[model samples]
Target chain A: MSADADTKSVTEVRPGATPAGPPVGARQDSFAARLRRDWPLLVMAMPMLVLVTAFWWVPALGNVIAFQDYNPFSGGILGSPIIGFTNFAQLFGDPQFIRAVVNTLGITAFQLVFYFPVPIALALLLNSVVSGRLRAFIQGVVYLPYFFSWVLVVAIFQQMFGGAGLIAQILRDHGHSGIDWMTNSDTFILLVTAETVWKDAGWGAIVFLAALSTIDQNLYEAAAVDGARRWRRMWHITLPGLRPVIVLLLILRLGDALNVGFEQFMLQRGAVGSKVSEVFDTFVYWSGLRTGDFGYGAAAGLFKGLVGLALILVANRVAHALGERGVYSRS
Target chain B: MSTTKVSGLAPWEEPGSLAGRIGKGGVLALIVLAVLLPLYTIVLTSLSSAGTVNRVGGLVLVPDGITFDAYRQIFSDSVVSRAVLVSTGVTVVGTAVSLGVSVLGAYALSRPGTLFHRPILFCVLLMFVFFPGLIPTYLMVASLGLKDTYWSLILPSAVSAFNVVVLRAFFMNIPRELLDSARIDGAGEFRILWRIVLPLSKAVTAVIGLLYAVGYWNAWFNAMLYIDDTRMWPLALVLRSYVVDSNPLPTATVGVNGFGHVAPPTLAIKMAIVAIAVLPALVIYPFVQRHFTKGVIIGAIKG
Candidate 1:
């Protein structure tokens, strides 16, 4: 109740709290008292702060290598020559790099069109099911695959559909020609989308289900009383109630469009070959480690980061324009 | 004393007809089956005899000869054994350390109007949006003289911005009056955090801990990037080599069995490795599943 009261009192408290800021000169004296009072928390917090600085912060500084020609054997980052825009120029000019950009964008586009609405659809259908026990059981089973590592997912797929896999054996048994969905370039995007859906569709449906719970029961009663059919009520009430959440998720997904997991692409790369699987992350992997072009790799990585940053900014701005809460800006 | 809300007592509406209910149930049943059948096949293949598997062409779904030979192969005095140990150690140590740090940072950042809080929060957001490049990250690790070390795996990933954000949200939800009362009692921040906040935050902590453990256990990319010594390989990396990189034969540098009757570590073995890689998370997941879902959006939507 106090928490609720505090939240409600925000408007009244703001101006008071702001002006109190100046007269709180003893705040300086109290700072030490405050710190002393908070010492236990400070102590509890020390390990995390130190570890983050030592590991995350220190390694994060290495992003500067994108400006330099980093050769690991040549005294590491310090000794690497600062080649500056040369790396970027080379990256921009390279056909493979361009192809990777195109490929990543294309994959994101496909996922946006197909994989985006799957969870919503699944959630709507599942919510309509009458059996509570059955619903929970199905939900549990559906979410299980999400916990499987990419390696396991790939292996499962391989066992089911690889050259010597289950479908092939089934075809062999039935005297039918097997479809080679695995190594085929034409269906690469579709395969990736299928994998995404199989792994995440059920798990991702969770938010929608949570949203569905927030809908008032009286609306449904009203619809029933007004002689609305189940389908009509669902279309009028359920879908509209879910729209805000869908828009929120769409913006978030758009922000992360570039990051189709590297492990999934890497696992299937050999089968499909780089011609199809050479997305940005894999391009960085190949160029940096396998090909030993650290500068170019750094440049490619920088490009990806910048584009991702730009996309998030654009997406958030668009969300704000549409009168929805974007990632950063609330309402 | 007053009685409050009651739930699940209302008579729920039965759907239109038995046929319709069956149709809905059938559709749901099919979806559940489609999701679980692959997992069933994998488990079956992992437990079957190699000959039976080979005869069946891929996965001998109906177990002709149910044997734990594949599991035996993975558990044998081979590279996998050491790899599993290393993976376990990394996961255990990494999760503990990651949770310790995340909780502290989250607590600090959760307090509104703290000095330096906003900047720290901004930095975390920046990290989430724009990552440092791989080469630079590799060079930084290598330059720090951490290559081939276990610390290379643990340290680089210790500061998860996502975890910090989640924990912070959980901490923020704690009653301010309770904290103020503790403060009035002259308890320090650390004392209050350790004594009060953490006790109340077991759910979020457990979920974050599980996530960190899984991330560490399933980490191969870091090892591949930083570690040159196959002797120091984690289970995930070794499993990747078996399943993806096509090296079923455990390398000479890796400890192998004497008779080499390991049967080229069959697809079943690959599944077994998958099982092994996933086993710890699977074990702990049921206990933490409820909290884990709540934790995702706390950080995700905030971002």
Candidate 2:
């Protein structure tokens, strides 16, 4: 939302923006001279560039393995036979892959409906509290779980809802049968959404809370002066003030729709079975690691990455069309 | 907080009705209790004695007999103890390296019009959207001969583009006059970043460092992927086996179980493992809690 945050798109390199430095194309602005002046800065940036290359860029290029009949042991990436669209052809034909895509998209839509409003509600509720001490205490308690790993979050849910968990124990004590919600595939989508809410609702609210704080209180007062009711003030002033943050996050979430997370589903895949638990990431993981169909898995993953890229660009365009600054501002 | 002097209301705002007050207070308290109750139960179960655990049948709620037997048992076990050490070392070293590299990168890219900064920043942003395919990354890691090594856990995940950008935002927010003042005094970018920028960025830096440390501590998948050797597993992976999978520790010191024997209950030990895994995050949270409003939100939300 600031001029500093948006580097003009990659096509444009405006050297005129440099501060207190010699203008580009100047006699002293040659590469060697700039390197002499900024060698330390380049040195500082070297480690990151190297790590990003080795980890990010190289492997991104390696996504080409998706196009090959990749066998890690015999052929490796280089020796693999090229098999254009065959893996993807196989991917689209497979019922299991179809199920995974459906499940992933289903979970994304489900969380958007059930889980997305939680942090907004939490921020509004927290903002209403008169006591800062109490609000901080709630934030500290709630955000604690966000730092916990998926293994730990799932374990906590298990302790609360597993067959021998506290709720089950309580039910058994009351002469009812104990049910293992952890293994209940029928409600797996809801279960994961609940888990997501429990872990992230507070952390997500931090963004909204920031937006809320930035809201002009005078608007509320003026609305009140005009005989606007509390709900009216909230609707007219508060929600609109938080609109940009909400839209930005919504776009980001839309871009991330295909990725419902790996470890969460992978951990539960045993209890819930792949039929219920399979998402895009776990599909790639299982088809790659478990079955060693590296090319097949790579194809599925490549499909996901490309779609995600498309989704983000499209979402950004949509946001621009809606007159909001999306992830990055365009004009 | 800005309107605190006006009795929790902006001067022009109306006071709440009794019903409204009751409703808000009730809902807020419920949210607080929902979060705390499970945590309380886990901690209580971790401390419960064998008799106490059986009395509750699972996840001891009412505290009857208090003993450190479960904690003592897990700590005494070589597997859990060594895993704890591994976790601590990885968290420390990984967090330091990540924070160092990220801060250095952020500073280098912090200056807006530096040489090739735009192209480099664009590269970072490009990676921010599209991660490398997982299978490809795994193959790369395996090909690099980093399998089963701690470096596999650290290197692949060290430089998060998100964190770097957030930190860079905070750095960029610093008044340019401050940096220009040092530049006018003939101080280099390194000297200026160290003396002027870093000193002013302690809170954001601390929050970022804690985020990395917590990430490193809580990470298990990397270890699960790369370090198949249970002997080299971190505490989180161990926690998964014992707590999530309900698998017994191979080196469990108190494997024998009876109703009221001296050994802690199996449930208590499992819960104890959960508690141990959660403790570092719990301990480190409050220190960073102070920075959430000031540092994290501004770096993240405003950016």
Question: Among these predicted structures, which one has the highest DockQ?
Answer: 2
Q: Cα lDDT for residue A96, model 2?
A: 89
TM-score of chain B of each: 0.88, 0.92
Q: Lowest summed-lDDT stretch of 10 residues in model 1 chain A?
A: A1-10
For residue B283, give model 2's deviation from the true position in Å.
Answer: 0.9
Tens-place lDDT digits, model 1, residues B1-303:
001102232233224577876887788788888877877787788888878877877777786868989888677756788899999999899988888888888887666444444345555555766777676677677767999899999988888877887788777778877977887898777787899999998887887887788789888889988888887899888888777655755565443565333445567777777777767867877787767556664444442
**C-alpha local distance difference test of each model:** 0.74, 0.83
Q: How far in Å is the alpha carbon of A192 misplaced in model 2?
A: 0.6
Q: How big is the positional error of residue B180 in model 1, measured in Å on the Cα after superposition? A: 1.3
What tens digits encode model 2's per-residue C-alpha lDDT throughout A1-331? 1123344442243444333432323333667777777778888999999999999999999999999999877879989899999999999999989999999999999999999999999999888877777777877877777898898899999999998888999999999999899999999898999999988998999889888888877788789999998889999999999999999999989978898878899899999899999999998988887798988999999999989888877887777778887776521
lDDT (Cα, tens digit) per residue for candidate 2, span B183-247: 88999878988999999999999989988998899898888889977779999998887778776
Model 1's CAPRI class is: acceptable
True contacts kept of each: 0.42, 0.66
Instruction: In model 1, state the lDDT of residue B278.
Output: 66
